[model samples]
Target: MIDGAAKDVAQILGHIPALRRYARLLAGDAAAADDLVQDTLERACAKWSMWRPGTDLRAWLMTLMHNIFLNRVRDWRHDDGHAALEDAPEPAHEPMAHAPEMLDLHRALDRLTPALRSALLLVTVEEYTYAEAAEILQVPIGTIMSRLHRARETVRVLMEGPTDAQRTHPLHLVKR
Candidate 1:
């Protein structure tokens, strides 16, 4: 039993980096992301027995993190004294080593709705399959596809300006 528990701890520890990455992208604030990861680890440790031995632990952990994040968002909405999560200023940090385009992509990601951003990050950044991402997000596969589509399009527009079709389309133009 001790050996089994030790193995479980090791496995859970192995997934922490992935959790931190996902949390950072999802929260868009390093401090908030670290808090989210810590919360997730605490919950996982408390519920370790409930996890099946052969299951995909990373997906399970991500599901817990996602649920926790959603709950926080819901709570934040009800709390009148707190500033909006999105309105919180970006945390100070060293500049990223990536190019200007990567910075733009990050900014575009920050602008996405939480649901859309979650879907995009799970699929693109974390490299989860559509089915896996759907399971993690507790949504249907079709819903994941739709969210990914919208998220990608929004990011593209934000990064590259509108496409030619968008520029030429009467419906996309401002009416004076």
Candidate 2:
């Protein structure tokens, strides 16, 4: 039993970096991301017995983090305007010397809705298959497809600006 428990802890530890990356992208702030990761670890440890031995541990961890993130967002929405200090807008800092396109892409990603962003990140960033992403997000495969389509289109529009056709006509009227 001791050996089994130690092995489980080792496996969970190995996924920490991935969890931190996912949390960082989802939360969009380092401090908040760290908090999310900590909460996820706590939850995972508490529920360790529930995890199936042969299942995908990384995906399971991601699903737990996703649920926690969504719950926090829901709670934040219900808050009475008493925002945390971390939620306060920070003073603008000089841009890093990174490539402009990368900066643009990051900004575009930030503009995405959490649902859309999660779908995009799970597939693109995490390299999960559509089915796997759907499972992680706890949605139907078709819903995952729809979210990916919308997320891609939105990011493209945000990064490249409106196309000439889009500028000339409403989005609905502009045929792809």
Candidate 3:
């Protein structure tokens, strides 16, 4: 029979692809994202005993990755030498197989703050509920909701500019 530890490792391994995607989005640099994923896996193995069996392993792993990403962001903010990924120039435009709308969405997403982006990704891309995302993000439910609202509005504004309802048009005097 496979040992419990081995089973845990297998489960964690199964989530690597997702972790990588989330990391890429959070880091915005391929090399940095890979490093983040590696760090997350290492932390998971070292902290395996803390994981409760019968719980959502994926959520737990996501939480670990999110925390690592946040720590890295904090360090980057404090460090003077290294530049944050958001400031890095956009990657050379390569032909992509995705739809144009998807590409536009990605560009808009890049503009959002890390907190908003993570909350949006968890709810929309990862299909996690507000409660699950809050647990993963270590924030209260209200915070997640607030982030989601802001993220959605930011993305909308970025992608489509202001809608007619939100646009303010200057009044023009007409000839009497």
Candidate 4:
């Protein structure tokens, strides 16, 4: 039988691609995303004892990555005379595709705020349930729902480019 540590490594390795995708969404740059994933994996290995085998391993790993990202954001913000965006390398341009829908979705995703983007990607791209996303993000379920709703609306508006109906018939909430 494989030891617990080996099993844990295998499980973590299986989820690295997903973690990298989530990190890319959160970081907005490919290199930064890779760094985030590396940090997350390192932390996971270092703190392997804390992880319980039977529970949701993916969720636990995501939580670690999210926390690490938040800390990085905090530190980046606090640094004097440090401009993170300025330091970031420019992304290489790729050839245009025939499919506009995919391009539009990517552009809309780029426009979203980090929090909204993370929430949307976790639920939509990663196919995580609302509860799982909430747990990974360390937020309440209601907050996750609210973020998802707003994120969806925002992405829709972005992809659709402010239709006339949006101006004439704004969305309204009706209390039940």
Candidate achieving the largest lDDT: 1
Give per-residue CA lDDT, model 2, range 18-55, as digits (tens).
99999988988778999999999999999988888899
TM-score pick, better of 1 and 4: 1
Query: What is the overall TM-score of model 3 with all chains considered together?
Result: 0.84
Off by over 4 Å in 3: 83-93, 97-100, 169-176
lDDT of 4 by residue, 47-99 (tens): 98898878999999999998998899788789897857779666656454578
- TM-scores, one per candidate: 0.88, 0.90, 0.84, 0.82
Best candidate (score: TM-score): 2
In candidate 2, what residue range of length 10 has the lowest lDDT sum? 90-99
Model 4: per-residue Cα lDDT at residue 53: 72
**Per-candidate local distance difference test:** 0.93, 0.91, 0.88, 0.87
Clashing pairs in 4: none
User: How close is each model in CA RMSD to the real structure?
Assistant: 3.8, 3.1, 5.8, 3.3
Residues 21-86, model 1: lDDT tens digits: 999999877889999999999999988878887899999999999999999989988989997769
Compute the lDDT of residue 170 as modeled in candidate 4: 81
**lDDT score at residue 94, model 1, on the 0-100 scale:** 42
The candidates, ranked best first by lDDT, are: 1, 2, 3, 4
Query: What is candidate 3's lDDT per residue for 1-176, written digit by digit as tens?
Result: 46966877788889999999888888876888999999999999899889988999999999999999888879878999886779967675646625887778878988898899999999998889999999999999999999999999999898888877566653545999
